[model samples]
Target: MKKPFRKKRQGGFTLLQFALVVLVSSIVSAVALNRFEYYREQAEIAAARQVVASLRTSLQARAAQLLSTGRERELQQLASANPMNLLLWKPENYLGEYYAPDPQQIGGAGWVFDPRDRSLVYLPRNARSFSFGSSKLLRFKVEFVRISNKSLALNQVSG
Candidate 1:
């Protein structure tokens, strides 16, 4: 007896299967991109905070040295000067001292000292989640605050 012939099945994915795979891949990519951005912003914020903490400590140490050396009158000047100068090792991102950096000159995430305003400006390169308010740069100033009845401390202020 003769056997009946049967059609051969295709070897590749069907059109609908291919479409589904592409859609799933695109979704995964989008979600991954969003998460990556969030983590990047968080890391930037943490690094900035570390720099600020170091600055505060250095300021206090310098003030103490001044007091010990009978240069108490110069503490006020120290508070007004560039805080970065007190750092034994500056961050790699620091763009160095700038009187008043032109917007066109500074274009990236880094630290800069603007003596004109007596503020340290942090220019965020990838600031998707940072709270910059009205401007892209986050500004901080160093000032002396009374910690107790007879003691003062150096602190960083956004204002």
Candidate 2:
């Protein structure tokens, strides 16, 4: 007696196919995450730079006004009236403090001045060593070396 014979075929993907899919997905995810981190770091750096630039401009404008009008006291008053306590200029406390001032007050971080040396410092969210250089003549440079939870250093120079 001859009976009909039939073979059933596999219905789903093989183990190798599944593994390849997973591998590809993992690679894609890793790339995305890396790109996200890079962008995040770049944004932080840009923000820090912007803060430095704004402070430099303000200081230069104020200094020029003071020299032209001989209103040194007005400039002092402007510095003192900083909305954030971070701008308390003192030689002993070069890194005065860090305050996230209202956006309307100051777009980014706060800053202090060393009236003696005419050097400007930009304080980050914490009392770290994040600072920039500014002279009475408005010449300035902003540096960023590293930033962490507790300490920050502006030891890098960029052209």
Per TM-score, the best of the predicted structures is: 1
Q: What is the C-alpha lDDT profile of model 2 across 53-136, one tens digit per residue?
A: 445555555556665777655545554443122223322323333242232344444344434333444434332223334311
Best by lDDT: 1
Q: Which tens-of-lDDT digit does each residue in 56-159 have in candidate 1?
A: 78877888888788887887788678889999999999997788765467765698888887888887765445765665567888766665522335444453
Q: Work out the TM-score per prediction.
A: 0.82, 0.46
TM-score, structure 2 vs. true: 0.46
Full-model lDDT for every candidate: 0.78, 0.44
Question: Cα lDDT of model 1 overall?
Answer: 0.78
Give the Å shift of residue 65 in candidate 2.
Answer: 2.1
**Steric clash pairs (candidate 2):** none
